[model samples]
Target: MSKEICFIADSSGGLPREILERHQIKEVPFYFKFQNTDYYCENVDYTGSEFYRHMEKNPEDVPQTAAPNVNDWLGALEERYVRGAKNFIVTTISSRLSSSFQTASLAKDVFAEQHDDVQVEVIDSNTCACGQASLEIAIAQMIESGKAFREIVDRVNQAVGSVTTLFVVNNLKYMEAGGRIGGATAFLGKLAQIKPVCEFIDGAVRPVKAVIGRKNSLKTMMDLAISRVSDWSRLIVTVQNAEFSEDADYAVDYLRKAASYSGKIYRSDLGVVVGAHSGPGAAGIGLVEASPLLR
Candidate 1:
């Protein structure tokens, strides 16, 4: 008999609420401290726009984001177990990016000790935001199709390589605060309107393009991403924005026309995982190549 697998991911997965509800996905929240108050974040305390606005008003208050506590994980899992969930797949943001994967791993061991009969697989998605969302969405489809547990897990592990995550930020201040970029480089980027088109290569961010204007940056990012795939129709794509829905709309429109892509695209708000670093007015596009099993 095939296993009845329940899917769980941190808020950073960037899954739209509709998808989350439809799949019965239990997304664990990440914590961010702002003004000495710890906010358990989903789409964030006040959405990306409000958070960024607050950041602008209080430039001194840098939100400190951390992984979910292990006890929190145990409680959530036990809640599901009591209600008949015996198998679970927990996916988290990249290990290189945050301690979410580590926290989930530790929780897995503790959960096992407490409930020896249950099965738990913690997946390090090796990506964040829409990239992580795309992976789990495909996995949920596989589970719905009655795939075995081991096969689904193996596919997700390999599928991480198929996801290409890229984005362009309005400014570099947030990246500088996160220690992803140098203060000097960020200062220069602000002076010249230089938007760095960045990609997650092996779970670490690397600059892929440097366009002068925001619109030009989005176009360049789309071009660079589309060039990597042979058929856009074979991809599961997601457009995630941090207070930049209009720009994300532009990205979706561009992809549809340029790539002849006519598949369902998830429009998501940037969650705390990537948003805390990418900050406001950032737009991200993630493409996941769908294999035969996922299709």
Candidate 2:
């Protein structure tokens, strides 16, 4: 029999459903409710387009997501275990951002007690949405290439630290709506058209810098990317958001002009799971590869 290692990820992994299905990866999606109709991310019950349309019609219908229960996680692992998957690696959003990491870790420890021979490694990722998903995809690719479990795990840890996401919101409306912006700053930002640059630092979203104009916001992000990147040729840029394709394109253009980009540029849907927090006009560029985190 061939060596079997399975990858299990939560909805926040940000990988497109088709790619996950193509690779046969297991996904335990989070829950969202719309107009009393329940939806699960990456589930057949609800789709990306449908979720966005629902949000458009009902902006007050803020979709909330909850982490999968321990049983839910155990069920996914057991299904793979029966199929001869002796080892499993589960990637989840950051513990600081969500309890999913904690939930997955507890499930791993509990499941390990029942099956001593099986090893389940849970990664916090210290990221959310596609940023978390990109790390999971990297692990899946390495496993598919026949890399050893230990080697894959080590590389994953390194990549987690290396991955960085920079978000530039078109307006502070969403942040204000989400109560992330304070009364003082929100008022000032709105009046001045000041775009705040937020990033995933360590495990949480923190305001790193601010720019006066959209152009500067884009430039600031690109400048940060260029400064952090060493070998530009190996860099892979993943741009994500529902309504900011133009911003994504502009970021890619800046990178092309400033650095070496050998890897392909992938644009992914920010989806409702993240849109709820970042808002509709938010655009972000996530830079990832096996390297050190740029300070």
- Tens-place lDDT per residue, model 2, 1-295, is 1257888888765676666876688888776675576656545577665666666677776667677778889999899898888888888888887788888888898889999899788988888765665666566667777877777777777778778777777767667766777878988998898988888889888888979998898889778867876665445566776565687788888877777564676667775556767666677777676332221
Candidate 1 C-alpha lDDT tens digits along 192-216: 9999999988888999977899999
TM-score of each: 0.94, 0.87
Tally clashes: model 1. Answer: 0
Residue 195 error, candidate 1, Å: 0.3
Estimate candidate 1's RMSD in Å: 2.0
**Clashes per candidate, residues 3 or more apart or on different chains:** 0, 1
Candidate 1 regions exceeding 4 Å error are 1-3, 43-49
